[model samples]
Target: MGDFVKKLKTLKTEVEAEVPNHPSIEMGDVICEHFAISKPEEKTVNNPTRASNKENITEKERNKRRKSEKEKALGVKKKQKKPCGFCGEKTNLHTKTTCPKNPNARRMPKPKVS
Candidate 1:
């Protein structure tokens, strides 16, 4: 019985000595929790060539997209006309009347022959 008591005491002392006085949370534990919550490894489903004909888009759809882009580039949404640099009057590229470089340009008179 005395031997048993001594062994029990020794075991208790050993366990106590190994126990931490004030155990702090480890950074690895927090990192594991963050990974579990965020789940950054989830797969995405975007196609690499979806924006172009490589994705099997119909011809009509492609034409429509092209037209939409052209209209946007030409500022078709706004009706206000841009002024010509020379004329100071609103004119589009298709029907510009006066050259912007010389608003008051006049043809020079031809030199009289001697």
Candidate 2:
């Protein structure tokens, strides 16, 4: 009887410690509750290649991921165009017309005769 009571107390403390003090509700859970009343059904794929494909992604998705990774490696961020060094105007790349501070904004000078 005494051993049983001690086991019960230890079990209760273990359960209490396992549970979080303040659990956060996940955004996915809220979205699923709003749109999908029931749990989403999971389908198992049989194809080994499809299952083991790069992060289980299609070829197109893999290509897009690779491109984005390459861009990141090259230190390029999407949707954030760099401002021109000559002018402070935002442009993807510096151009003669876009850069007001460019000295060669006008037409190139004619070649000098020898």
Candidate 3:
């Protein structure tokens, strides 16, 4: 136990020395930069085509583009979702060993086996 603690303390000191100034960045500065409060001039999108060219587009074309953009923003594409594996159900939910209905969930051994 003493050796374990000594080793842990040594490792802590070494890690601290290796990672000095990790938090040199101020959180306020980062938030301001990210939320565009401090530097509004940094917005590179000077002329967004969607809003700028809205007057030129026809009603049908505008509706189609708006529908596609809404679908993309909501991740409603046909390819992203697949069937669930647990019950072989056609669902968009995720499938993994942790799924409750998965038969294979109970087959994996617990940590106690080690």
Candidate 4:
């Protein structure tokens, strides 16, 4: 038991020496205590680039971000009303998606042309 703990502690120290700022090596004392092993005194380093648990951005900025996200989600959306793509004539009846003139389009009852 003692030899295993000594090996585990040595292995941990070697790993810490290799990667001082590793996330897994952050809570050295907690890990040691959990495994019934004692660790030497070590300085805890706080990451400078880490974000705080607070909302710093403005409401307008947040709204703008949300608007852009919505726009991206609904990218290049076609207009409900547009000119006939197949027949190449502007009309109120249908667009390319619903145009009867389209060869590959499903059989649909086309409006009467008078």
Each prediction's RMSD over C-alphas, in Å, is 17.2, 17.7, 28.4, 18.3
lDDT of each: 0.58, 0.61, 0.60, 0.65
- For candidate 3, lDDT tens digit of each residue in 8-111? 99999999899866656788789997988875556766675455433466767755654445565456435455565665655444455544577667444223
* Candidate achieving the largest TM-score: 3
* Candidate 3 wrong stretches, greater than 4 Å: 23-27, 39-114
What's the true lDDT of residue 86 in model 4?
Answer: 80
Sort the predicted structures by lDDT, highest score first.
4, 2, 3, 1
lDDT of 2 by residue, 5-90 (tens): 99999999999999878767788888877997755478665555443433356657765644445565455434467666567766
- Estimate, for each residue in 3-36, the C-alpha lDDT of model 1 and write its tens digit: 9999999999999899867767688768878787
Q: Residues 1-114, candidate 4: write the lDDT tens digits.
A: 999999999999999899859455558767887899886568587568745343466756754543444464354343344567787776656667667778777656346433
Clashing pairs in 1: 86-100
What's the residue-level lDDT of 48 in candidate 3? 52
TM, every model = 0.21, 0.20, 0.28, 0.22
Residue 5 lDDT in model 4?
100
Off by over 4 Å in 4: 1-81, 107-114
lDDT of 1: 0.58
Of the two candidates 2 and 4, the one with more favorable TM-score, higher being better, is 4
Point out the worst 10-residue segment of candidate 2 by lDDT.
105-114
